[model samples]
Target: MTWEEIAKAKKASVDDAIPSEWRLEKNPTANKVRNVGEYLDETLPARENSITSCTVTELAGKISRGELSAIEVTKAFCHRAALTHQLTTCCSEIFFERAYKKAEELDEYFKKNGKTVGPLHGVPISLKDQVNLEGIDSAIGYVSLVNKPKNKDEVSNIAKILENAGAVFYVKTTTPMAMMSGCTSSNIYGYTYNSYNRLLSSGGSSGGEGALIGARGSPLGFGTDIGGSIREPSCFHGLYGLRGCSNRLPYCNVTNSFAHAPVLASVIGPMAWDLDDLKLVTKLIIDSEPWMDDPKVPPIPWREVTDYPKKLCFAFVSDDGAARPHPPIERALQMCKDALVAQGHEVIDWEPPVSFIECRDLGASIYGADGYKEIADECAKSGEPIVREVMVLAGNGTDLPIGCSHVHEHWEQNKLRYEYQQKVDKYWKSTAQQTSTGRPVDAIITPLWETCSFKCEDIDMFSSAYSSTFNILDYAAVTTPVTTADKTLDSKDETYTPISDHDRAIHEYYDPELFHGTPVGLQVVTPRYEEERAIYLSGKLRDALSERR
Candidate 1:
């Protein structure tokens, strides 16, 4: 079949899942609407409207108290998600009927047994296209794989764990082809626009999840990150995104870009309306002891703590000596620093432990582990031309997969990654000497991207040093939105000069008007395998920061 035919059929399958009663009477995408949530509130029935507005914590509490039924909550989210998809084309698949059925079952269990299903009993959780939902296709934006149901063992453990704990699944969001771009786009489902701002990108790989949550379509969703797939979208869409050390969550059974990437394996994490939901979801997953099912998962339980010193130390990284952040991102960093300092925390400049440019480039090389052969083969399977956003970055096919000739360099890449991790680890430990609290700095706050948002395919140069370097170091990190890219205050400075050619190219795209009102966020990072502590402190910092409110 022609690529166009395949793409059309895939979209039709998704559209067929939406009940005609829930379909949007008018498409909102054709006009200018600043806030999708406000539109949803005013347009949807008050019953559905109120249900979709509750946060995960509140929704769970409401259900547990018998104030709201699971079916009502699920129906509300499904309808809101439908409206959100109509406005932004954010979803790649929809299974609202199944979600409603699950909700009904939960309600029946509650009526008969007189107890909630689990911690997330009635919550409507969404997922990225790369995450398998049994009986449904998790194609991850490949037309060739459309309508192919995932195998039982091939389903992600996190999905199974969440489902077992009473979380209802309704839809899977869009992802870029091979999940390799800085913005989400593909020949199959098309581009997913930012939910808040229509003209700018929603962010890549996990962009669809970001847009969905940002619009309040779903209170919580999951996204995976090897580089900045999870965090970038979280930052752009004003959600809390968590990416922990490898296997801190479960990695088994998800669809991946390549068959194997043990060298720098990607981690699955959550994106939510607030830190409360983020912490709640992480705790539930850890409590389930996922290591039993997927041996790759570390047998670490969530470390619950309530006490933290009032005075703490932090490292602020505005740039990695490669791509300096644009004015808005820099302002966001400053806002974070000022907020912490005002609350009596010590904030200082941090010269990175290793060359970010070197580590980031090395990281990019690792992404091509199979010489793009896997993604290349997938694209070839459907004759789908690589989308513009990722064509130049990943799929032009310059490098070949592992071969006898390339064995030496492949091994060397592993050595460098290990060495880089050690250097950063040592540097992190050395911070004890520089802090008044007499411990290594609690966390490092840095820019997620150079600017708030960009137009489709506007990026020419890229670096994931700020976020990916943590992936290399195997640290735990959380992205918390700090402020917005307001044209009035985050104006570009005429006297500013780019630090590098790449910096100049990225900086040139910083039009405050274009990025106005887009969310600006920073990454709060902690040492490796410290998911519990990382989330705790990040939440503390988030609460202390006035701008975050």
Candidate 2:
């Protein structure tokens, strides 16, 4: 079969896997279905609607107490997931039958044992396509990888961990080819649109995960991040996503590109509609001692952080010094600052010792250290053209970057990354002298992107400096939704002058009307291995914002 035939068949298989009863009679277009979550709320049966509306913690509690059966919960999510995929193209693989069977088994275990199997007993969890499952394809948007199923030995460690805790998996979310792009568009899945506003691009790599969870197709899901794959999508859809320090969460057996790259690594974490749900899963995974299974994972047990100074200090990064944030992002930052101040928390300007510009450039150099040869070879296998959005990673959008000429060049990038981390760490510590509490600021809050999101075709014009800088520092960051883009409030600044050509393009791309209704989110970043603190601070931020609301 031709590559086009393979891609079509793969997509058809996912659709075919959905039961006819669950399929939408007429799939809605972006214009007609701007917000799928709301659409589903009004259209779904009352029971399914209520079930999908509950947070992961609520669902688990109901299932544990016999108020809801595992099969029932699974059915609700599976149905919603089927509809979400049809509307957003968010799913790469759908196997509701398998999920049902597992749910039944879990129910039987509960009946015989007189107790829940685990903390996550019977909870439905969605996974990115890179998460391998036995007999399922983790093709990750490569037509050449279609039809190749993973073996039992190849299952991702994260999947195994979740399953052991009685989680049921029905669908695998879509990803870009080789998981190398910022927007989720590939030859196979085409594109995964934002769930809240289908007209916008779902932030990539984990774009499908973002869209699915944004639409509440599943209570919670997992997304990986080397460079904002998880945070961008979460921010785009108004969800909470964790990008823990490198190897803080197990990545063992997960399919990925640059798997052997020594200079940088990707980490997998949870994305959810509720902060508590995100906390529950992150702690559960850490409590499971995943390090015992994945040697790379450090044996740092989940730290439950509760005691913080009544008057906390926080560092706020308004811009990256190159590209200024669009109107909505700027307003969101002000909202956060005002909320924190209202709560008696200190909000200080953050001027890191290492420039974000340097971090971004270093990240790009390391990302293209091999000139993306693996990506090219994989696409070449099936004679498919590289997706345009991903072309920039190759070089100048027209040619592949020349890989490092020597091993020493690769070492230099690694050295620079380490140096940047050291500088930032020192600066964070130095802030204690400026803080009223004589302690370093509790966390640094910054924008996830210059704009909340952009049109699907304009993805190539955006820069990732806002998100990827943390990746270079190996910091733990959590995305928190603050507000929506409001045309009446967030107008483009005509008086501002661009500092650079890249900045000019980003500045000129802003249109209040076009970006209106999208979610504007920011990231709460903590030091490496401080996932607990990062999440705690995010909860604090949410509380402050809620009080204001």
Candidate 3:
């Protein structure tokens, strides 16, 4: 059959498979349904207020003070998430029933003990579809993988830890096919849009999680990053995300694209609306000792170090020269540097010893070495058109797959990555001598991407050296929004000179007005495996920016 014919058949099959309860009236008028928020307030008592408007900490305080019950909190989040999914197409599976049941159990425990279950007690958390939860599908946007029953009790390492700590799970969020693209759209659930704008991209492969959190559907969620997956979406949606050192959070039961790839760079980490929430979730997850359950996890617990001095050293980089950041991003970087200097923190211009361009290329080769044949084969079964971003990176479904023999070359690249990391380490160490604090820079503040959220087709040509370089070095990186895209400050640089063809295209893609109000995020980088420090410093940086504003 022709591709168009297959696409039609797939759509028909999917339509027929939808449960009757989920079907909507064709061309229904506004009168046919209540606004989701209003419906939730009417049906659920806890949702009389907006659950999305509060932070995880605020919710915890309410629960502890007896002002809220676990069931009430879970229901409020579920209601909001259901609405978010409807608006942004963020959720892959709804687990409201299971979440409510768990919430009831927590309430019962509290009633008997006169105390909450744990730190995360009644906090509702969303998971990417890659994290398996027993009966739920772990399709990761591949229809061929759908409906495959879990052979074993498929509990994710992170889920197990969170469950033990009393966190509630309400929904499994969506992802892109193969989870390799910068935009989230799949044959399984359709396109996910920016909750803030809807007309623009949400930034992916963690796009759904970003949209859900940004829309206030869930206060906290988890997303994995290999390239810019976690950070880019977080940046675009105005959320704080940490791409922790690989193995800091367990990934054993989690499904991903490079399942068998020897050079493991991708990592799963937390996403939150606020920096404190990110820190709270990170501490709770790490304290659970993921190493016990997942052999690959390192034995790193939450460090209670308060060693950060009042004064800090910061390194700032606006452009990596691989892809010059758009005007708004450059301004955001300058604003952050100025804020830090005004706060009495030492700021230094950083030119890394090694080129970021080389790192970006190496990272892409490692990630796309399979030539995405696995993704294509999976997509063929689903018969969904490849999303614009994926097509740009891997071409229109005709690229040949990389041969198995290339594995040896991939191994050599991994070794080179180690050497590159050591060079970074040396550079970081050298900063101590140049600072008044007598310590190396606490973190390097850099732009998360060239644009707030690039047009889907432009993502392939846009260099993601900002986040990818950290991944190559296995450094802990935290992303925080400094400002949104402001048309006045983000005006095009008419006098700008092209750094390269790729850089010129990236420059042309910028539209200050189009991206207005989109989050412009900056990264805070710390040493490898020092996730606690990264979180704490991110909190400090966030506070500094807030104070300035």
TM-score of each: 0.96, 0.98, 0.90
- Report the Cα lDDT for candidate 1: 0.84
List clashing residue pairs in candidate 2.
none
User: How much is 191 displaced in model 1, in angstroms?
Assistant: 0.6
For candidate 2, lDDT tens digit of each residue in 1-549? Answer: 889999998999988998988878887777877999999999999999999999989988999999999999999999999988999999999998899999999999999998998989999999999999999999988999999999999999889989999899999999988888889999987989999999899989899999999999988999999889999999999999999998988999999988878889988999998999999999989998999999999999988896767999999998988889999999999999999999999989999888888898898888888777888888899998888878865557766764554789999889899889899999999999989988999899999888888888887787768789999999999999999999999988899989999899999989887788889899999999999999999999999999999
RMSD of 1: 2.0
Higher-ranked by lDDT: 1 or 2 = 2
Candidate 1's TM-score:
0.96
Clashes of each: 0, 0, 0
lDDT of 3 by residue, 434-509 (tens): 8888888888888887788865444556657887888788889999888878888778988988978888888888
Give the CA lDDT, 0 to 100, for residue 397 in model 3.
38
Ordered by TM-score, highest first, the candidates read 2, 1, 3
Best by lDDT: 2
The better-scoring model by TM-score among 2 and 3 is 2
Model 1: how far is 228 from its true place, Å?
A: 0.7
